[model samples]
Target: MPVPGGSGREFNYPDVGAGRDDVSPAGYRSLEMVRELGTGDQIFDAASRRLFGWQMHRAAGIRLARSTPPPAPGVDVRLEWGVGPIRASAWCRVVDVVDEPDRRGFAYGTLAGHPESGEETFLVERDTDARVTARITAFSRPARWYTRLAGPLGRLVQRRITQRYLDGIADDQW
Candidate 1:
């Protein structure tokens, strides 16, 4: 669980950069993308199953040091990204879940000593028309100064990763 004011071993709930703050330019930024994938409940179910099974992380090439599938709120997870010379790691905890009639998914945020600051939510939904869509929404800012300096380049990388996430959940069969 996150601690107030973001103290030691504690992350921020709703995540520090997750659009709750609006006063600062460097405060937060949000991105949302929705892609059509299959149809009906099965589509949502497939994406939900993939999400909980840690397949999305696999698709993103992220390695879970302590693998815990089927994320539920409050589960802590350690993640490693990149390979060989370039590597980054972080400890995060799942903060929210969406299990409503229209949507299903969850969100996780970084812990106290993470390299980046933010929260991201993944959702799979079946609309009234029976069209299923997978959507990702992220609000983030760099915790490290170097990452903050990267700016536009960082955004480009994020964009690619977001697309990859969309691709990861695009299923032909429900």
Candidate 2:
């Protein structure tokens, strides 16, 4: 299924549970690019940084899977760009699997992050026109060393990284 948001780029996931599935997060469909904030990651009244974010619009399907499916517990995930890459691997455990009448199928995962990701997935719904939609939530505790180094701009720095990621996605054709 082509995620419906941008251009309904076709995507397919096969034998997702045979092993670890290398599904693209962007393929979850209806991945609306919201917004990126912060001037310098300031957590106070004002931020020194400004970045992109989402306003609101119709959602749609996305292409997010490899050309071929692998076996179970054998997922290889990587996000590559100019910065380098964020490679994460995990044994996937499917959460909820459902195909609804609203023109959407939902599938969440228990093996999210690296060796230590929690639980997350897309409810996978569609709009009146059948555009996909879902939310992705991510949380991380402050690193003690990094937090101390931040002193003040810790949040701003974090926001910067996020901004970069969002920019990459928006600029990317995929």
Clashes of each: 0, 31
Which runs of model 2 end up more than 4 angstroms from their true locations? 1-88, 110-115, 127-132, 137-174
Residue 60's lDDT in candidate 1: 75
Error in Å for residue 155 of model 1: 1.1
Q: What is the TM-score of each candidate against the true structure?
A: 0.82, 0.30
45-102: candidate 2 lDDT, tens digit per residue: 1110100111110011111234323211222222212323543223333333334443
Whole-model lDDT for model 2 versus the true structure? 0.29
Identify the leading candidate in terms of TM-score.
1
Flag regions of model 1 displaced more than 4 Å: 1-8, 12-26, 171-174
